[model samples]
Target: MAKILMITGDFVEDYENMVPFQALLAMGHQVDAVCPGKGKNDSIATCIHDFEGHQTYTEKRGHNFTLNAEFDQVAASEYDALYLPGGRAPEYLRLDNKVLAIIKAFAASNKPIAAVCHGAQLLTAANVIEGKKISAYPACAPEVRQAGGEYVDLQMDEAITDGKFVTAPAWPAHPALLRQLVALL
Candidate 1:
């Protein structure tokens, strides 16, 4: 089993955040979910994103996800893998300098890293996806491209692994994403 650091924040996709955290734990991996400015036992809000035949997914309030680790205390070397869930949270989480450093540390260490949907935003901010074929919600393709990554478009339920990076379009690709991650781990 691997030790994983799950970096997420308020308003992270409900299913995306919960499913992987639980699934990895069930697989005997130790997953530490953390959010900047939060500590163990603190909770973050989550939201549901549904494709309702609109131009994009619609959002709704979701469960309160509890944090099991303190963000300020995490050391990239302490974990064997990293998981980043997508949602509105990445938009702001990408702005935290420490967050960017943590992401870079993971990338530099050649550890496995997984990101879905808007999680690409953080990867781009950290400048770690360059020369990689990365996937994310279609809207994030431009950011991925601008970051020197080749944007890969795939079905909603698909995932792609390039080097140590595994990415997907959204939560629907969890099975594929996790499968690829398990292989990497």
Candidate 2:
């Protein structure tokens, strides 16, 4: 099993992230829930209650918890894959130099990097999407294209994998995206 690192922000799509996180654990991979620090407080708050609305979200609760490690604290060499869930968090995360560095490190390492919806924003910010074909929420297409990625308009059931990168549209695509990510593991 691969050692996976799941990165999030203050408020990611609560359900979309949990499914893949749980699937990785069920597949016997060791997963770490990493997030950026807002301040001195080490605990990262997530809308746990809101996440329960989805069936897949409920199953992923076992390993659901926060890690104190800021983006800069994460070591790229320790993880086999990086997973990003889409939401407003990506917009904020993209501005942090540390997060961008981590993103770039994962891309440089050629490790499996999975992103969904707005999470693609961070990928674009890291400048690693150049010449790559990926999928994201329709509203984010222009940004992806501007970043040099070919954005595909597809159903959530469809999973898009290009090289070491994998992407999906939104919450509905969680299952397919998780399955594809597990296959990579």
Score residue 145 of candidate 2 by CA lDDT.
98
Summing lDDT over every window of 10 consecutive residues in candidate 2, give the lowest-scoring window: 56-65
Compared with the true structure, what per-residue lDDT tens digits does model 1 show for residues 1-185? 89999999999999999999999999999999999999999999999999889987899999999999999999999999999999999999999999999999999999999999999999999999999999999999999999999999999999999999999999999999999999999
Best by TM-score: 1
Q: Ten residues in a row with the worst lDDT in model 1?
A: 49-58
Off by over 4 Å in 1: none
1-185 per-residue lDDT for model 2 (tens digits): 79888788676666666777777778898877777764323544444322456654322222234553445568988999999888667899899888888889999999999998888999999999999998998879999999999998989678798898889988788778887877776
lDDT of each: 0.97, 0.79
List runs of model 2 lying over 4 Å from the truth: 38-65, 68-72
Report the Cα lDDT for residue 85, model 2: 85
Candidate with best lDDT: 1
Residue 73 lDDT in candidate 1: 95
